[model samples]
Target: MRIDTRVEINAPASLVREKLLAFSEHADWNPFFTSIELVGCDIRDSDSQVKPGDRLKVSMKDVRSGKVSTFTPTVLSCTAKKFEWRGSLIGQWFFSGIHTFEFLEKDDSQKCVLLHHETFSGIAIPLLRPLLKGTQTNFEAMNNALIEVCENGC
Candidate 1:
């Protein structure tokens, strides 16, 4: 399943990119991602910003699990307005997936688009199809929150 939605922000592209690229500020903007606790990050050695091939140990928790889920994701892309990460589900037999966020320059500001794509093979297809609806809802909410933050100067 793939879901994509865009929101126009009043802020300039640089500010929007900064908020999206900074994992440390996720708690204030992202609705689904409660927090990104860095258990380990490859950037510990130098001043270089995170890039493709960089790995991060992220701890995330939500209402569904009510418990933190830990996993390691390899950064796939970290350009000026694009960020993507790929990871597998830990402590489970679920399929591996990719999550991406793209911020495109609009007229005077930016258009932030969130993409959630999940690929499942075998018997899981039937079970996962129905779940995509809820997943889409959450993604929309997250986009709205991001827009609000950008518009309100958060």
Candidate 2:
């Protein structure tokens, strides 16, 4: 399934991109992500801030789960307008998903959208369908957080 979500922030695309690219820096504004416990971080040798091959180990706690889930995401691509990653549940086994963040200029303001596209394979569909609903809920919470942070200048 594909989930698309857009959020408007009272900031320019450049600033939005800056805030989003700093994956470990999410705690500053992200509500869904309680913290990003980086087990590892490696920036590419080139001028790229976050390269396609870079990997980050992060810990995310969801209010729905009420438990922290750790995963290692290998950055697929990163640019001024887009950042993409393919992630796998590091310890606990779950379905794999691709996360893409897009920064767009909307009129006088800027908008950031997160596209979460996931595929369920094998016989897990029957059980995992309900679990995927949480992603949408999480997206709503995240949009709320983004608005609050941008409004409060966090």
Window of ten residues with lowest summed lDDT in model 2: 113-122
lDDT of 1 by residue, 34-134 (tens): 66533455445421277787776665544353455667877788777677777664422564557777766766454444433433334454566775455
For model 2, the stretches where C-alpha displacement exceeds 4 angstroms are 37-48, 89-94, 108-123
TM-score of 2: 0.76
Q: RMSD of model 2, in Å?
A: 3.8
Candidate 1 colliding pairs, count: 0
Candidate 1: residue 107 Cα off by (Å): 0.9
Candidate 1 Cα misplacement greater than 4 A, ranges: 37-39, 43-48, 59-68, 90-94, 108-123
Instruction: Give lDDT tens digits, candidate 2, residues 61-96.
Output: 675777677777777878877877777543214555
